[model samples]
Target chain A: MISLTRASRWYGQVIGINDVTCTIQAGLTALLGPNGAGKSTFMKLVTGQLRPTTGDVRVFNQRPFANTHVFRRIGYCPEIEALYDDMTGRSFVTMLAAMAGIARAKRAERVDEVLGMVSMSHAADRRIGGYSKGMRQRIKIAQALVHDPEIIILDEPLNGLDPVGRKEMTALFLRLATENRCVLVSSHILYEVEQMTRQIILMDRGRLRAMGDVYQIRALIDAHPHRVSITTSRARDLARRLLEFPYILSATLDSADARQVTIETRSPDAFYDDLPRIVLADGYRVEELDSPDNNLEAVFRYLVKG
Target chain B: MVDLYLLRNALRDLASAKRLVVAAILIMGPAFIALAIRLGMGSQFDGVLTYGTLAALLVFGFVLPILAVVFGTGAVSQELEQRTMVYLLTRPVPRWRILLAKYVAAWIVISATGLLAALALAAVTYQPTPGSGRTALNRRSIVNPRKFLAQLQTPDSPVVDYVTQRLSAETLEQLSRWDPDTPAPRPLLRMVLTDLNKLIAADRRLYDPADFPEINVPDDARQLMAERPRGAANARLNRWLLEAAFPDLIRTNRTTGNKLYRDVLVLPVGAAAYGAFFLLLATILPRALITGLFLAFGWESWVPMMPGNFRLLSVMTYLRALAPHARPQTASTDMMQIFQALSPDTVPSALAWIVLAATTMAALALALAIFSYREYVPRDDAT
Candidate 1:
């Protein structure tokens, strides 16, 4: 487990992370936050690239700052696009594996394995300078996994990846978690994080706003109003019926379309359960229904505001 | 083991960099100049030695240091500028080892290039048959021509008559073409006189001192005559003349000695010291290139010109201290004067080398300390 106790890092009065205290245990955990939300700073702290300004951070009961013992067990995929572009993908991964203290005899096998794992074996012999954005991301991931560290911390690993690449990476993270390795991935895209893992640690303005499984955190913010949009031919009639339900806090018609209605509800679970009954009784031709607050973005907004 | 790995990787990266090509061209400048000089000018051993010395001075004193600074200062900063430092920083190896590996790699490049250039310059200018078979201009025979004439003024001076008879009319006419008061005799007259002097000395032992009593011997000659019986005085005088008049032979000896001193000692030590110092500056300063330029051009250049012990701060001063003191035959008097003025006072070669080694170690240690403690954040990540 990696733990941060009252960890605060300040760069000349601009706080990167302010008094953040949390523990990341074994499993795939998504670090969800907007840009400049202290996610990168937290990753740097955990990877031993930085030290907390006021508090303590420990990876597996020992300090990670310049701690080779901890570093050997941890793999970090940085968010920055920095790489030795002149080197072939295989050479780059092998070089890092060697630096990570892997035995010379095992470096080639390990590099090939990680490259295959990232589905980059086809382009492994090509120079990274000519690789596309998705290829670069995959090569970066391959280097991070070349050492087979116990903890893999990737910041924005899905950035620039295509749909298929994202699916493959998501599966890779799941496999890592299944093997009991701690996979803490930071991403600002809510849907991407949601697709990767249900466990998330959300942050805003350099503070940890919430941490838990997505569903559990969503349950905690049930008191807040949830926004759900409905598309139907009889939107005005649905809005009137939604007001009749006591759980519906407010309802509004779409300005451009009379067939669309947006409604707010105090109890999302109750509303979701009763929505089919109401539609069936009124015989409204509902084409689509989506609860904006059901995903991690709404959970983050509600928890940050609360 | 980790350091070695890092070093190997760094060397590989350096080999692929385009800057290495530029650096190689810069160091080869002296070698090209030496080859040109060899082709244009005749390979007179003294002339070649003078040219070689000047080449060594240009390379070791200025070009080598600038190259070392350019390469060494970029050793770590290049990684930071490209934002690839994070890869090495995030590795399990210690930060000091990373810095050290890069430093060693840079040193290897700079020293190898500089020494190779020096070797090429030396090889091009070196003469295999130095001071051999050049009897026409025996420098010893020309020394103190008036004294030689006075010695031959005796009535039964067969040696003088023989020399005058041996002189060709053309040579005599050439000798008379110059002003009588000129210090230097005509070339043919000088050669004939040199041969005459050698013959007289060889035959002098057959004659008694009383037979040449009118020949006024100088105090040193008289002491030599008293110290040794018979013709030993003439032999001593002959030895002194050969030693004094042969400027080419003296220059040849000095140049050979200087070449060994410079190639074997000064260049390697200077390259290492400059490389290490630049590595330290690169680690500690944000603008290492500008600072290094200032130190190399502005400070090192001026400090040597300052009066009285002020030059002790300059690396060039220590280098000059370690260099052989023989001035090149082609060097201008002004250049010689400057070199003499800048050279430190009687510093032993061993002491100078020790100072250089100590400074290199200190700079490397300081670089390691700075690299170990300093935090490097990628530019895009800095908030």
Candidate 2:
């Protein structure tokens, strides 16, 4: 739904987004990065707020800058918490709906529907200035969704949300994706992004580091050592047996608890497959097995650090 | 449709802003001062008119422009400062529409406030008293030629020769028919005398008999020879002087009042142009308020005092060009003389409005273009 070709944006001497190229399709895709990692810059570029200093950015095969037709199809929720404090949430959303070319007769209905989707209908009559942080975030999301655009781009939508609000928002994003809408949400929060979708575009220092499903990204970096912990009473025995596997780089008994063992493996898949077999053959009691590098955090760490 | 929506939103926001209250207060300051001066000093309608003109210069010229800067510069800058500009910019509406809508919103507020103040000042300062003969006469006569002539005479016996040389044949015949012994003057003579008096008074020194040596006489005669007789010719000459002066008086009063009226009418237009100018400045300069203040108060006020067409750069010149020509007496007033350098020729009302309209359109267009092309990054609000 959105594409960038060698797109770069520079703010005088400061680089906002470098010469990075990527395409995003319809789905709930998380843009993962650390602070100042050009995630917001990428969002702005795709949303057509900032033109790339070089190359091009296109949405639906059209340049989005001042393109009203393309803009009608795209909804952007900026990261800044700037809102008209004097206006009620409903009015704010309705105003945006009107600007989006929603029929005047239907704007109220559209505003209500979007506000309900974000679970902000109950407090929609209240001025945004008096709203809680989570409520403000919800209202911001409501405005972005008010027009029912094909592409919805949110930057740090989960920044000020409570845990329940986050859960609701994640579900809303999932629902949007299910509706065939392209949802690209940018965030530095790993767990929230993981909860939303495995499809992600990771960035760092104004450069795209990796893009794809979290596991696929993780799999690509399997050459990096993986750390696994085994909470078993027979720590020394497990450690000694683990050394027998050629894929296991090293193993050691936990310092605080002799019952626990930690192992580094060059191949985590081979280590897991051999673990149950050895336990069954030796009749050894296996309490628990946990791979710390199994999730997106480990994947992000590897990609960003490497 | 989008422009309408944006304009509606901008107007709503302006109505809710606390700064608008301050702007209204600033706009009314001149009216209040005029009221105070009118009531405290028991001044006449003419005094009120003069006060209104002075108010236009100080209030509309200086204060209203500052108000425009305050409202206009903040129209966009406030949104950017608060980081709320994204909401407006991200909408499907065209960028120019957003800018134009905002500019119109600010202009409406400023113009409405300024015009209200102007109307109030005009109403307060123009309370005509009921049928006072002296006031009527004051309005009818351009100059009291009798009083002017008396002021010009000294203890010199040559006054009759001077009067004979200056007066026209017709006026002299009329004067002679009433009292030929007093050396009657005609219309041309009266005009020459008036012109000479103007030249002599231009320097504002006392009239000296030494200036005219051809009409030699004794120094004991402190008054004109014509004053010694109470004759029909004297009365006829006085009647002729009135005839000569009335049309000019009526013309001066009408033209001056019309000019004042025009200035009042164009205050709103000037306010809108200033607002747009400030808004344009705000787009590229971070310290737009400082620049607006410097331009409105420092540059606009000071530049018009400068000689040559260089004053054309100031917006005040255009506004002053809409003012009426100053009457000689009023022009000679101490306060009016202080601002004499700043006064401009009275352009036609239509031409003045056109200049104001063109200025406003140009400023708004520049502001719209700047906003459309520029990329705005969210800045720290605390800074």
Full-model lDDT for every candidate: 0.73, 0.71
| Model 2 bad stretches (over 4 Å) | A233-245, A270-285, B43-45, B129-261, B325-354, B379-383
Q: Report the C-alpha lDDT of model 1 over B204-266, residue by residue, as the tens digit.
A: 532333344322222222223333434644554433323222332222222343454456566
Clashing pairs in 1: none
Displacement of the residue A272 alpha carbon in candidate 2, Å: 4.7
How far off is residue A36 in model 1, in Å?
2.8
After superposition, candidate 1 runs with Cα above 4 Å error: A215-223, A229-263, A269-289, A300-306, B39-48, B129-250, B255-262, B329-339, B342-344
Q: What are the per-candidate TM-scores when only chain A is compared?
A: 0.84, 0.90
Query: A-chain TM-score in candidate 2?
Result: 0.90
Number of colliding residue pairs in each model: 0, 9
Encode model 2's per-residue lDDT on A116-185: one tens digit a residue: 8999889999999999988999999998888898999999999899899899999999999989899999
Which residue pairs of candidate 2 clash? B166-B189, B167-B189, B168-B189, B171-B185, B171-B186, B172-B184, B172-B185, B172-B186, B178-B233
